[model samples]
Target: SILSIGWAQWILSDLPQDSLSLAMTHPEMDWPTAHAACPVLALAGDETLAGCVPARRRRQLRRARQAASRCGRIALLSASGSPQTFLDQLIRLHNMRWAEQGGGVLANAAVEQFHRLSLPLLDAHGLVRCWLFAIDGGTVGAYYGFHHRGRAYAYLGGFDPAYAEESPGAILIGHAIAEAIREDAREFDFLRGQEAYKYGWGAVDRWTMRRVWTRS
Candidate 1:
């Protein structure tokens, strides 16, 4: 006997006693609606939206200096760079500076909260991810957006408020462009933002169009 069953809602009333019942709390679908819906939970692979961030690289200050000798402004490139790693370490260092300036102690409990809860969310994405931080250094700000695979994106970033004058955000993004090139990603998406920093980086306006789907 050949039987074809199109499973949709679960038999909650008869949830199995064993581990099989764990998946019983399922959703219902209206066939006609399901057929027409083009929504989040059903959308296929993200071929167009995904972006990959290149590997961290080092920027040679000397090359930059040398380039300045010839061009209007010299550019330096480094492949052995780890901005995320550097940012993480810088965060602790800056926190001390903050304390020295009477920014209040970085309560151990507050840090613990970030490590346990915030960091987890940032690291959950297999393709795209972010880095969290406590503070920033004088030159290098504490920025995150650490690791990503296919179509990686810079989720969020932060810096030492005192260095706000330095535009740490701009520096982080400048380096980010090089990293994105190294990754050979199709696009470098800046998630959502209409901030000046986004514009300073020469990023253009792009919409994340959403589609609603429902089952009849």
Candidate 2:
């Protein structure tokens, strides 16, 4: 007999009663493991997008935007034709900050190549989105994410550390969240991680479980 295993599978909805009963009745054949939490921001509220987050975060974002503006005009640019250019920018900007720290998620050639090959297909499906943050006409940050099935997933981001005081990443996220609202997404998912910044945006955790099946 062979066994199948799944890890950290996102549980977006309740399981059928029959499925639960099966798992309980045949622990050896099927069972659940520890759960992982993902931070998600509800976008279905009646409040405006600006009001979706906490007051403190709003104030902080204001200050950061003002600070960054002082350097130059800030712009959030979206990829229209070929998203590859924006993806490259993301990799460069991300590496500028994470390289010294032993490289970021996009640092490896394999990872970069994977995105290069997959983005076009995803973009064709209208699921891929990339936003570049620029100050004084120079790009300082980039956000890579996806919108699907009424949810916007904040997948990855990279920023110029030189603009640390300006909070380019945070500012870009604010704009991205607004875009998500315009798209009528029901939730803005942070995907995975317990990063403190996610909570600042009033994100709540949703749990997912690992399910395993084995032949007896």
Candidate 3:
């Protein structure tokens, strides 16, 4: 048996007939079993950061910025070279944010190890995009994602929920979206979620699927 996950789109139609037999024992069940909706924000080549969001969201963003500013001097820093510091901060904040919900996606040591091993390689190839949001030298938020081939994929992020009123997560994401546009990414993919906030940022649903295969 074999299983493949996180395919951005269906490929059953493109598969060779011979391979299809080996790929899935029950195509219909396998196709929809692990499918999920992903939100993606399409970017026009010539849009201001403000233009990426709808009018209502733009107002919310403005208020978030103002609230965050009142906390301290706000700063958004891009990660380069070794990103251990950013990773550490992100994990801490992420865990803290989701602690009440059991834990975060990166709460496992093995998962942390995966990022440690892979981020450098991705960074070297200019695919890794990470940012840390700080207030008065203290990190409050982190955005860890990838950008490649005109698509910026927002993989994961964490922010200090203590400042939820300031919308730190939203602010970090908004900045990342603007940065993606600056880098000429045609799409900002908020991967695998139907979260209401994703739609607030003018993102639309794009589905992804996972499939498993068993020997006949």
Candidate 4:
């Protein structure tokens, strides 16, 4: 059965189930499948941000910091008091970066609407956290994600291409991980990506699977 296959491959790979039965039936339909590699940084027992990465990455982060500092004042702002005010800026900064690269999730109307409507609710529940990296009073980078069940997930982010050479994106990520550690999160999850930068933070690969069901 499709359900059994999904359970075996994703939910619980070690579980044994020889015979499975399906009580419902439906017509077959085409379904799409998606795949992603999630990178995760495990935090345990008073580990400092610098301690979580390798020596080479630490040097890179140091260089990024110096470069960002030279551009102007670099600040990491979070969505704590007035989240609404930051949401607009976050979207704008994200679009600025992705727009030049062609497009991104925010380019879709439905996805943008979902984020607008959900941000407040998630904020109220303390599940969502957003960060903006500003330079000399201008927003240049943004990080939006959720913290749940002791895990801090890096859901989405963007940085001004103008600062690409300055490495604002990498700097922001470094700050995010530091903040997560301060908040006592057990793990920092780079939700879905095989991006090389994620590995610099000492993140490990975790496979994700998608399940599709069609009745025959």
**Residues 21-104, candidate 2, lDDT per residue (tens digit)?**
335454443455445778899885433456587879888988999999999999989874577898889999999989789999
Candidate 1 vs candidate 2: which has greater TM-score? 2
Compared with the true structure, what per-residue lDDT tens digits does model 4 show for residues 1-216? 555553322222211122121222334422223346788988753434656777687788889888888999988787665676776777676788888677877877898888778888889899977888889988888888788888898888888888888877787777777778888898999977688888878899776543334433
Q: What lDDT score goes with residue 116 in model 2?
A: 92
**Which TM-score value belongs to model 1?**
0.41
Error of 1 at 61 (Å): 13
Query: What C-alpha lDDT values do all the predictions have?
Result: 0.39, 0.81, 0.80, 0.73
For model 4 the local lDDT of residue 185 reads 91
Question: Model 3, residue 45: displacement in angstroms?
Answer: 5.6
Give the C-alpha miss distance for residue 159 in model 1, angstroms: 1.3
My TM-score estimates for the predictions, one after another, are: 0.41, 0.85, 0.81, 0.78
- In what order do the candidates fall by lDDT, top score first? 2, 3, 4, 1
RMSD of each: 12.8, 4.5, 5.9, 6.6
Superposition error at 56 for model 1 (Å): 24
Pairs with backbone N, CA or C atoms under 3 Å apart (clashes), candidate 2: none
Candidate 2, after superposition: displacement of residue 215 in Å?
5.4
Candidate 4 error regions (>4 Å): 1-35, 45-48, 210-216
Arranged by TM-score with the best first, the candidates are: 2, 3, 4, 1
lDDT for 14 (candidate 2): 31
* Regions of model 3 farther than 4 Å from truth: 1-34, 45-47, 209-216
